[model samples]
Target: MRGFLHLGCVYAHGVKNVIHVMLENRAFDTVFGFLNHTTDIENLVGKDPICNYVNVNDPTSAKACTSPNLPSKSQYDPDHQYYATTNEIYGTNDPNVPLPPVAPMSGFVQQASIGALKGAPIQDLQQVMASFDPANIPIQATLAKEFTIFDKWFAAIPGPTQPNRVSAHCATSNGWYDNSKIIFGNNCRSIFEDLADAGLTWKAYYQENPPSIDCLSNLRFSSNIQSYSNFLSDAKSGNLPSYTFLEPKYGNLPQNKNTYTDGHSGSSSFANAEAFIKQIYETLRASPQWSSSLLLITYDEHGGFHDHVPPPKAPNPDGITVNDPNHPGVVYSFDRLGLRVPVTLISPWVPKGQVIHEPNGPQSDSQFSHASIPATLRSIFKLTSPALTKRESWSGNFESYLLDTPRTDCPTTLPSVVQF
Candidate 1:
């Protein structure tokens, strides 16, 4: 990555560099649904009392429902792992329970209580159903309002963070569905490798500790990974690579709300995440590359939160399924997509208030998944290498959404971030 390479990529749009900010667990409805309450955006509007999930312990009892601005403490992280997600989607994690014609999308409270089980204590089960008001995370809501936001963006897989993030980079997870700490050295081919192979410079700027990007062997030995601090200086100087993927801080968090940047429920605050995102947006806005740079902000998965949208069937990247002897359960086919998550496109090329529910391909029927991150990069940079997997080839990307002309009136500064 240390040479004067040929600029082989064509000018498809005004964008010369792309920055993708992939954050942690939170449902699209939990975060962006406030728009529906105030505007006509397809979200949890009018459903003031969002889904009243059944109390398994007592059928006559009413459990958690969606409330604005985090009505109470997010007791636990809300059990967004494999089996819990299954219960959250299908209303039962029991393998015997057949997939319904329509996903029940009705087990958040149950899953949060004891996961897939029939009888469980309903202690603080409201965390999974709690939605964020626009005032809670003003930065994200403002960006969605001022720029372009995709309503049908789903996570790449119907599982945890690691697998979906792997799909975000590798275009497939090599059949891993859960976030096992032992997933290192799996040798998953990533977009960073593809960029390096194509001689297009790229960097993965991370905060504090290493992110799930370290799950791939290629990035383990890569020098392209740098601290989040470099992101600020690099953006200030506008000396960014062709592609940049930013990862927020994860694990071992301090008590300070202003620095809780990861945005994961129960662990970090929305205001803290807003502070982090505000810096990135404002820095990029003032950078020399602002006019030619496009920023994409999204999450990894829904984290077992309540999203009413039933995920559509997804095209399998590879014909692979989970096979773990230690954890024997339903063998996941990786065919269905995870819950909806917010994906916003911030750039001078995007039309304000634009909402693309489906991919703007020739058919324009398929919705976007996390794999579209690499798929869009491959399409934009015009990489020579073949797609990492079939899913990348079929991934609904944002290549067609970019305008040929860049707008001169793009905002130079974002709205004020929420503070404690």
Candidate 2:
């Protein structure tokens, strides 16, 4: 129920606007994999010597797994369902299957091949091991070159979009893994509630209504939800809220056209997503609020792409475990984080061309996950009591990357999306 006019008055002291754009289903190595091929730009992919792994079950896995020759323009959506993501992560397609003592991280090609064989041609399996050219994702790549990129940022859960997204907003999915059941009745407290409790304002902008909306039981917050057009208008007028969550257009909707920007499979090209990002950046840069705003661009899930890095063990968000009757006997403790996803932090405050990774620690290596979203918000708002979850309570904050002074050399525009 908070209005834009009141946002300025309520948040005048040390209050900076945080804009989060959550894109769908892209892995770090899947979209930015080609950055490893670049010589001058120091990146996580190519720093280590390139090596190939052998998967006897997967004939297509003999060569170097990360290939730029993989089709970037194709509309092939890899299998990112709950079990499929498990296969892509643990390298085992079977659900609740025991993994070897030394996890191989070698089941991608086979999983893709198996996924393709179901309702898709067997020959299309090669698309799973393929990645896009860095040139094709110039906007994201350019941002990485200009701001801070998290090579170790991971999804909160190793499942599908709904659960991972729920973690980002609520710190826990409330014992649900897939997107089947509606969450409005779940009574979960979201960051939205946290912001409101602190007397700060927030907004959720979507091209169309996203699945996350159903998770919120309170209809009073519905007043803050607006169409995507309102986002552009607010950005230009400097009427942005203290926190903004933006959702790209999911391609499955009836109104979605060839210019889908969500970057999900079946989209015409990744160019659409780049163009969308470019516009958002330009709008923010041109506004008076640019200096005071921080923009975070990240993906919800890995979308079944091949990533070399294994996910690290993580603290359980809530004590309640997920015992889904559908996957009988499959108990989820929410202990392990998901695969790596591309995470770029853009602001005048961040250092140029900075790459952040896990810092040494006695516990687990320092890494960013979807839980970091709420954790950072809680830190910024200075909320003291009633933490969301232990995972978020221990998560690292991105504010460390913000500089005491702002950079004037941030690029205003990026290369146009190249058509295939």
Candidate 3:
């Protein structure tokens, strides 16, 4: 394992570190918390709650990618571009059928505006609460029937894979914006660097293996990272980093047993990701580290899931112009913005149903940027490297997810390692 340590005097003396596991391509669309269409749930209720969670392919019929605005040089019509560039992977619009108006923000918002309320009459909580009969419901039912917790969700961005992943990590795309160049530039520091400099040990674990392991011949930092299967070796040898990342092998098969080899996106799979995550949670929660450690479960990005909110403006270094905010001579900064993938922070400290409503955006103090995952690690460990933890404020404080009073004994029961 590659260790990151800051020997400078500014560091805090000692801290029991953290491990970050980034589960790539898992989305809230698959989670139980929220669903774009509630009607889809009427049939699944009273069944296994796990049935509520589904893979992207389950809703593939409704999977539609939209492009808000595309540059003219790209292969799309700005006025009638029904689908974005990435949507081309599946199919393009026929054009003979006139494109509908830009996708509406919300079905509720649209229905109420147009005076066409269907399904149930839901004006407020009282109406919704009275409508459901609890007598027939199971006591173990975990999801809320009706609740409103607000947070930032992405609206207009459209793409398939790598661009969305890069946007979530750095908050800006280096312009490769698509999977065609997933291996482009690597000169910049990631949220991981920020935490490492702060004296935290972080690790990226892949179910089958690590990412970018074979392509080290191009950019640097190749040897710095390791695979997920090797985590046990690192832990036994005391080389465990503060944060850990897990990448899936595109399909369900293990990396070595593949008879067919597609590119990175094709070769990587998720068939065993859910089981792997559960195992990791069980190991940590059963150990003495449950209270102090935090686990962030989020998708790399939305694989064209429909979210009703618009992408908010963010501070960008490579200024791109966006008309909504109306800032002159400034390029659109994606730092604090992008589409919403399901982000769930799992730890003993994270209260069940505790929704963080960061008013400004994810990068705001109220909201946490994905980068905040590393920021909290840096603050907790007190590594003093500026470059690595430069964007700490934009991220969240992982400490908030810990218990106010330290635990003398470990938790008696662990949360069922759940996947949707």
Candidate 4:
């Protein structure tokens, strides 16, 4: 097992607070992948050349292209369900077998067709293959250019929201492989618990109700969770916790209108998500903690959108594997990571326009997933003991991006989205 001895050596220099904000759905390519068309950004992070198609019937006549626009509200939800995602990754709906070593990642369009045809109209179904122009999401594109972007960051599971999110909070998802298993009744030890045990301060701020915080098994720390309204006040007062997890509003239901900034499927618009992020950035920049803080912005999963890169092999979280009861023959060892999602690291300690896609040392893998969240917190907080899981213990930390001297000219504001 890797020891926490490396923690003191790495984080002892600066960095007092770490703020992580997790958004919903959007894929790396679905949002900023088009930035590859620009020479400078392309030279820095390379590109994802995978383009999708749309064909409900006659597969031979399928049109090949990337969807160009993502409206504020989607008419149909992409197929991000458990089994659908498996097919999206493996290019086959065969749940009876383990994923082959050579996953072609070519089944997105096919699986999406199945999902779209279920209850959606023909027009809505065709939108699955569509993507947004980088020009459409100016805020994210601007931030990616100004801050450090992790081009290879991935979700923790090949499935949907809940499982992958659980992986982010605690290295292991227990035995879950789908969102259906997620409920308020589920319990697990999370990074919050680890932080508390080490005598550190942490907080979970939600726009309305807390989706992720409810996953925690121990209710003793419930007091640490607060409303999103309190977050801005805390930042203004310089009373932020050592670690903070910000949750966006999950949906745009009537009650959620006030807090609904999450960019989930069928929501008002991605502009809301960008605005929410900009608000956080501006608030943090004005806070006294700005100099000593690191902010991470990322998504939970691909949300059934298309990402060209294949997930790499991963360490099994707890040396345990579970067979999918739904598909009697399918078994998972938690040894493979999920599809790619955009992750950006912002801190004055990081260089402007920095792209982190490879491990600093040759011994580690370049790819990172949601497990890196707990792994990083464990390392920085010096929580010496067994890690939540072996996978997190082995995951790479982002400390390498922090420089000896902080940059004073980082941007204080980002571009706004231009509505059509």
Candidate 5:
């Protein structure tokens, strides 16, 4: 539904900056599958219906245009299953190519053990789904050795956005379970609270003035401190918050048609996401705050992309069985994590070409949850707060990459941060 533009431009900010790039809805299997050989790129880059009209002179004609990759249904039904329009476009389960069999237990927990469970039988679809090879893991070492910390959000658990996002802030995934639900408030005692308590200055920069209810309410902070569309302006004015939470603009652009109407593949969200990110990065790079700041780019959740590896089992407090919806009686325990989402940590302190192949969990090689973010914040500001949860311990710690040499790959100069 949405169209993508090759902006073909690079913008940079000033100095004393740290940026976190959250790759939303990035399925580990999908990303790794394509990255495995690169030919699989088609699996993700579906033909955007709006692309045909992106630059067309006629808005009416653009409205009439349609991409075959559009989603056929509005919402997933409990009884009826849904198939991705992307699959139908390419005429196969995987639009790219039939991915190799997912390795058994191949996620953060799995990789921590160096694929020790490859010979074990994959018990379910979750196991069969995690086929991403760690050999080509994208945790650039340069980034890892220099920046604060590099890790995965590890959707290794299940449920939906609210729970996962809560996990990102709270460590425990039991707070909320639905997209339309609110689990936390402004005083919800998050990493932001911890930072503020420690006399640190941090703010969340959202793309839209106010994000959806969940994002707006979950953080529980007032709109005065949060700027959805003014991130560019804030950066340009050297008004960098101690921490910035960048979110996708949803679907306002023509390229992101599905995001607006729900009739398409939500490719517009992706297109807008890419453009917004470029702008943010460029502005951040050009800002005076580039050197001292840190950026954490991560997605809130995976958007049901085919992953080829299995997420390992962690203790689920709410007993939400990941990947299994058949239990009509009650939420049951799942033996795996949720899908894998992409997370990027950018800063002057991050090492170049360094990949941290850790699990993102408290244990070595374990993957992380959203709750880990607060932990990282806590560490950065040296805050004293009760542990968000058991997994919270694994969330923070800049020691690994903090000592690495700074990246030489960054540009010497960048574009000016945009003004509101």
Candidate 6:
């Protein structure tokens, strides 16, 4: 029997625990290109010149060679700024060209070479074309092989962290496009509110102080926020709420204190990030709620990495626009999605080795983005409230991915991290 919608939405089979692990800044290709080669998922794998990272002006210029194994981090963050991404997407720094119907995904090399991105140098920039081998992060790869991977998932916008992160919970950034001056405006409501309104229990857990969801106007003072340590104890005690969102440690933290597990740009240690993923997975697998649990491991945005897939056209959320939020005199109507990110849905109810190549939704413009987070919650929980934004209204849901019956062969553990 299919999981039917209920008040405290359980995975049709039984009571469910939906744990969302929101990581930071990695493109689909940078993380999972190994699986999608002469295959489907859009990455530079098993190809002649996996990716041409030559100079923008001169194709034959010397640059960092594309490698399958990216070091723990990059030389610098790389330029994912709103205007810079426009260049990376279309592969041109030209200011006056019609927005190409299809993006070229060609200028990443040049953009990374610039010093605009944080901690990056103006010269000798590299690592943007790097892709992780399945062996590089064995646990992440094993989980994907063992569960479902959403190949077409994208960020909510083509800009940086703030706006996209806001969209992940709120379904819209309310016309904000850049990391310009605002960390997050107190303008939009988030899915957290929806969960609360419906009498459903949830919590946003963070390893660092001030959970990322706190930036949302509604969650600033929410009592539902808790420490990640609580997540560990709650999972073991089977006291977890209906919905859970996790924020890894961000910013600088001494190795002794706690390594940065957020994995932002090239600063974080891949070893720490992988271990964090492992810890969370093992905890969930052993939990009493394992059978009905669903863990979504995903990134906030591309964070200036290389993803061969071009972002698809999208409906403007709430039909709002930003007039030159970053670039003066230029306007960004929220009509286009951003670079692709990895969305791995892990659950006992999901068939092993499932890969969702396209959307299961009926909307013509249906492409799974951050908005899908709210949309899927609404469907699985049967929320009758108004859509958070026009975007989620048109977004797809993954309730169908949960199998009618829980699988008996689900692994209780994953391969150990093999970070190189």
Estimated TM-score for each candidate: 0.90, 0.88, 0.56, 0.89, 0.61, 0.91
Candidate number achieving the greatest TM-score relative to the actual structure: 6
List, residue by residue over 279-366, the lDDT tens digit for candidate 3.
5555665555555555555555443333333344344424543432233443323343434545545555445444544433223333
Error of 1 at 152 (Å): 0.4
* Tens digit of per-residue lDDT, candidate 2, span 1-420: 211111112222233899999898888777777774334332335545333333535555443345665554566777777777777666675655685544455666556656743444434555665567777677887888888788878888887888887788888877767777764445668888889888999998887665355566663358788889999999999999999999888765666757678777665677788889999999999988998888999999888777777887788878878786777887878877888888889998888888777622213444578888887777667765466988776566665556777888988777786765
Between candidates 2 and 5, which one is better according to TM-score?
Answer: 2
**227-251, model 4: which lDDT tens digit per residue?**
9889999998899998999989887
lDDT of residue 164 for candidate 5: 65
The per-model lDDT (C-alpha) reads 0.77, 0.73, 0.37, 0.74, 0.43, 0.78
Residue 260 of model 1: what lDDT? 49
Q: How would you order the candidates by lDDT, starting with the best?
A: 6, 1, 4, 2, 5, 3
The global Cα lDDT (0 to 1) of model 1 is 0.77
Which stretches of candidate 1 lie above 4 Å from their native place?
Answer: 1-12, 36-40, 56-59, 71-73, 115-123, 181-183, 253-258, 324-329, 362-365
Candidate 1: clashing pairs of residues = none
Q: Write the per-residue lDDT of candidate 5 for residues 313-372, one digit (tens) a residue.
A: 455533334332433343434333565565556666665434444432345434555655
For model 4, the run of ten residues with the poorest summed lDDT: 40-49
Clashing pairs in 4: 67-130, 67-131
Segments in model 6 whose C-alpha atoms lie over 4 Å from true places: 1-15, 36-40, 63-65, 93-95, 116-124, 181-184, 252-258, 325-328
- For each of the candidates, give the backbone clash count: 0, 0, 33, 2, 85, 2
Question: In candidate 1, what are the lDDT values of residues 44-97, reduced to their tens digit?
Answer: 777667664565446577677777756423436767887888888877877766
lDDT of 6 at 402: 78
Candidate scoring better on lDDT of 1 and 2: 1
Which 10-residue span in candidate 1 carries the lowest summed lDDT? 1-10
Ranking by TM-score: 6, 1, 4, 2, 5, 3
